[model samples]
Target: MEGLEIGLNGNLVDAETQQEGGRFFAADASSSNYILLQCKDVLTLEQKEELKRLHVTLLSYPAYNTYYCRYEPTELDEIRALPYINYANIYRPEFVTEAGLKDKLENSDEGHQPPEEKRYEVYISLHEDHRNRLEQIRQKIIQVLGIDPELVNADAFILRAKLQSHEIARVAGIDEVQRIEEIPRLALSNNHARVDLNLEYIIGAANSRLVVGGGLGQIIAIADTGVDDQHEALRGRVRVIEGSRNTDARGHGTHVAASAIGSGNSLEFGPIQGTAPFATVLSHVIVDNAGNITWSPLMFQRAYNREYGARIHSNSYNVSHAGIFQQRQYDGLAQDCDRMAICLPQLVILFSAGNSAPFKNVTSDGEIESQAAAKNVITVGACESTRPMTRNPLTYDYYVAVPIPGYLALNLAGNRDQMALFSSRGPTKNTNGGPDDRRIKPDVVAPGTVIYSAKSSQLDLTLPNILPGAIEAGVPNDGRWSYMNGTSMSTPLVAGCCATIRGRIALQCHNLARIPSVLVKAILINGTKWMVGTNQDSQGFGRVNLAKSMVCFSNHLGCGFWPKQESDFARMQMIQGQELKIRVPLPTANPYPDGITPRFSLTVTMCYLDYPDQSGLVDHLSLKVLQKTRLPDGTFPERYGNKLPGEPADNRNNVQKVIWDGISAPAPFQHPDPFRIYVRVERLARDAQFLHHFALAWHVEEMSRGDAQFDFWNERMPSTDARNRFMRKD
Candidate 1:
């Protein structure tokens, strides 16, 4: 039981003294113990060995080269057998300082600390071999400081370990595979040439009146190819981080920046404007002309370190192969990596899920590395939209479908109907042999296929780059103001949306913290759409429907299924009295401003719990409303009241009840009000389940009034034979 104690300052003492005095064991420097020797100016291995023979174990040395140690009274073999050595220097003075040691010593006052400056005392485990050495070091520190060694405690320090950059060339089964092109021969040339702008869908889904500004007027660091600061869309929005020579020679950075928050006119040719046009862009060009990108976690940290309030960051460029090795020494410089602005809660760093696809094992190399893989950041993926092209040559216009005889489909060419095979997909699985921790990747998807956005004409207009071959393949006239596709293209869409959501939430709720990244994610996921045949993995949640999402949030519509009531109170009154029955009709369809489908069943139930005067009078009245009903003006009312009314409205006379069924609908009902009801209530005040038997019948209606032809409702009809049968039978 004889153990040695070591301190952070390299002081040591015997185990018995440590236990009785209250000192505890701390860290082990055996792996990097040489770091301390070098700090002490012990140059030779022989000198180090000689010092070791003196029974002194060297602890860590501060940056100032101060060496500290403790003496291990027991032999190395004996020390190795002890369960734990007592170390002293690891104790945090803050805890004892903020809350006086006397208070902490009182068992009754254990949890009673000041609200603002609370602290916790902790202990760290040490290897058996290093136990005595660490203990000895602790004692020496107490001796040097001349403090009561017994009062010493230990504090746990978490080391910031950087993960190596992982590169995957392709995502399995998704990348490089040509999506089957359905010939655009609808037989109607007018329809073929004329694209549906679908502006109604966009306008209906989004609330144009609610503008969410992004970020402080402060700067956000964007590591990408050089941004187009001069471009009208990004002109005032961008603030180039000076001192760093990084510039977007490749134009990738510009596209990424534009996607993040390009405010240019949506009417102008090229792609649509970004999600957060009002947010300032801090452009940090990281990609060069040769397609060589020089970036590290350190570079991003340095950029943001200079500006603290810069809460937003977008890194579209990544190194495929750079990460921290487990055995490597990352004590100083590497530890500083966590101090990066991106690591802070206020800053939201977004990265592209990566362009590599079709090979699940491969990704955009460093795209999933630090910062992107960091716990707090948001990662976005791309989704292809089936929306037709908008042609307004005066404002902005382009062909959205493929021209005859072209094989390669470049996004800029305006084929919005297809998804680019290269856009990355993920639930970033554990890559380094460990637990299968799935990093929720691609928080949301956005229009990435054939997206027309601002592009740098400088790169796109040059020779072969914009030649017939390139044009035939669908590359834009120049990289500028051209269209592009990839998760890179998709990520900024979500980032912009995030800024918008954050801004609006902050303005309206005055509760910014309530808007966690997860909620922002929920909005986007809940509004997305799956492709013709893909599942959740390919089209996570759905597309980013900012307008619909904002409305849902405003209305307190959560992601869970809508609440249901077993019985309709309105129908129960009829069964309580023996009176003449009256009929109410139900609507065949739902009526809401927005033509979205209801996902659950609508029902109403009525029960006669108690009989009048204990007479036990009950009646099973089956009443159904005719689908047809007339208003005072003789025109059909929007819906039929589905329930029946009994005369002698007073509660003592008679009672009636009705129950709505879980009926499916093959096609949505056009109108949603004046629903009819069917009632069959038996006298059952004594029966517990009788109350459950009663149901309410009301017409389900859409909430918004806008053009319905262009709505996503076109895709909501039931196609399953079983569901269709259920709907028809009902």
Candidate 2:
């Protein structure tokens, strides 16, 4: 009465005993025996019947495997049953025999390796089940061949052939950089100008004799629509890193790279140069034929890690899908990608905020989504200029597609305060209660509306069909020099600015990481002008004023208003019976270098009305030191209120305290030579509302020395100035 066991597909079963322990059998009787068979390729009918005759129960048979299996199982009783198998219902079978399994594992790299190799070890990315099976097959191979698996690893390694020369040539020529050609007056039209980028601004900001980006030997990686190396503006500056089959497929990348560092000049039919002008470009194409940026950040990581001396990477594409952060796969990849991006010692990654403007809600996925959301990368947004118009009013034909008066001639006036409605708005907030962390989309906003830059000759002319009126207006619309607008246009502006700052810092300090924080502070404070009614959400810190920033840098005056101690100070103070208490406000700004110390001067003007009884007790004032306190061990002590070397002591007489009488009659002061003490006023009536006004001025040597920046003000001012003005009473 021994229990019988069976095996199928190498699954062991004992006919004498039902216990689990037994020698491996090729077939089993129980329905569970089907689990042992690997369900990969199809099985034959003969194999199925052979399996059935061996008393093995078949759970499923793949169409292709049906030819390998023999004799299908049928009922033994007096009952007729048709085989419950159909083409659609058939399932693939796994390798049953040891030799079959070994063959399956060994053939994994069949087509991947070169033909010269006798044997190849393939690195296969497989599911857990397949990996386990492969591991078992490896052990069996070692046992049968009497060789160590480690020693066999070398013989098993696969060898792949290098890319063909033609393929390399094709990729190299994909986005061949071209020289910019000057368009004649006949070609000059309104449609062409709309796409014209402000190359002047880019060049002007980068014109610094003290700093040149030419010999830094830093490589800037561009992931976009591939570059036009043949463009005159970009001629010798661009170097292709990775070119896809669909090279020259798009002009976005070329335009972006040129805007950042084009070396040609537009006036002489020369190159329409960029901001850097001499920085080498390492181009990598990421966009596809569908006009979509489908490549993930992993591709960027691969590109970055492949080379040793690469630093900066720029991408002008944005994602449309918003749920990337919610998915585990995307989030993990994003974090890893960000780490990879910032891993380089001097690495700086830049991304376009997106073009989904006026809408203000939509965003993209992968790099676009990750860059905007990633803390390490710089995300750029677009802003339009509203300064008084300086250019002449040129008459041009208007577009019929535009809702405005069509077919009418209009002056090209630049005095405007409007921003493009299509430029994307960020500080991305996800409504879906997922990990909706608020990302400050654009760290800085640059001029992106109707920018002019170099383009490729191969660009499809049909693209203008999207906006026929824009094309016919002759607004610098040539395929080489286009006037496209969007945050995509704005991103390179900031990236160029970053390059300029980095170059300058490298010349002076030899550190690149210092540039990000320094530039962030400068742009946030000195370079930014506060626009009325705007908050931090929309406009952030306002427009980037390079002139003002340079001025601040030279003057050493820290940008932005320093926070006064009064803002955080409490009013009441305790006084001891035996001693008088004196309080002084501390200076909020950091001190300059030792020899060039900041000079702080305070002037107080006091007016007093003569009273008959108090005439003889005229207001008296004197300055004196109360007590000097040491800073705590772990804390950075306040510097302003600290007592100087020499000073008089606080007096008990109420009428002898420090005082100011006015311009005509000044009050006496103590200890004026070596050092002055805190000024105080006495003899004031208890009910009096004493006017205590003082002006504190200090000189700052360099704005770049310390952090003097604030977040940008959003553009959301109240409808009326009176309602939003800080000084207004109403």
**What TM-score fits each model?**
0.45, 0.44
Sequence-dependent TM-score of model 1: 0.45
List per-prediction Cα lDDT, in the order shown. Answer: 0.37, 0.37
Q: After superposition, which runs of candidate 1 have C-alpha atoms over 4 Å from their true positions? A: 1-208, 211-220, 245-247, 265-272, 298-308, 319-342, 359-375, 385-418, 431-435, 438-440, 457-480, 511-519, 555-730
**What shift in Å separates residue 51 of candidate 2 from its native position after superposition?**
55
Show where candidate 2 strays beyond 4 Å.
Answer: 1-217, 243-247, 267-272, 302-308, 321-337, 359-370, 385-418, 430-437, 462-474, 477-479, 511-526, 531-533, 547-730
lDDT of 2 by residue, 1-730 (tens): 2222222222232332221333333233222212223222223345345445555454222111121121133322111111322111111122222122234334545576543333322212111122235444444434544544563221111111122222222221211100001100100011111112222222122223423453244456777767778887778767776445323545677777777776555542344545556677777776655454544444555555646334567777654533222211112223333444433324567777665442222344212243454434566666653322222442233222234343234443332123333444544433121123233344556666555677665565454323222233235524457655566766665566556545555554433233332232332223433334443344443454433333322212221211123331121121111112233233233222234322222211111121111102112223343222323665321212212323342221111112211111011111112122333443332112222211111111111212322111111212233212312110
Error of 2 at 231 (Å): 0.7
Across 1-730, the per-residue lDDT of candidate 1 in tens digits comes to 2232222211222334323244433343232222121122212334334446755454422212122344444223333232332222222221111112223323324356542233222122232234335455444434544545553332211111111111000100111110111001000000110111111133332334444344324345677666767777677777777754433435566666776677565443434556666777776665545445544444555555646334556656332322321111111111222223214324455666554444233333222333333333455556564434443221111222324233232333333333445545544423221112233344555666555566654444442212121122234444446555456666666667667655654565443332333334433443333345543344433455555444433321111111122132233344322222223322354432344444422222121222111111222233333223355777642211223232221222122212223233423343242344334332222222222222221222122222121222222333433222212100
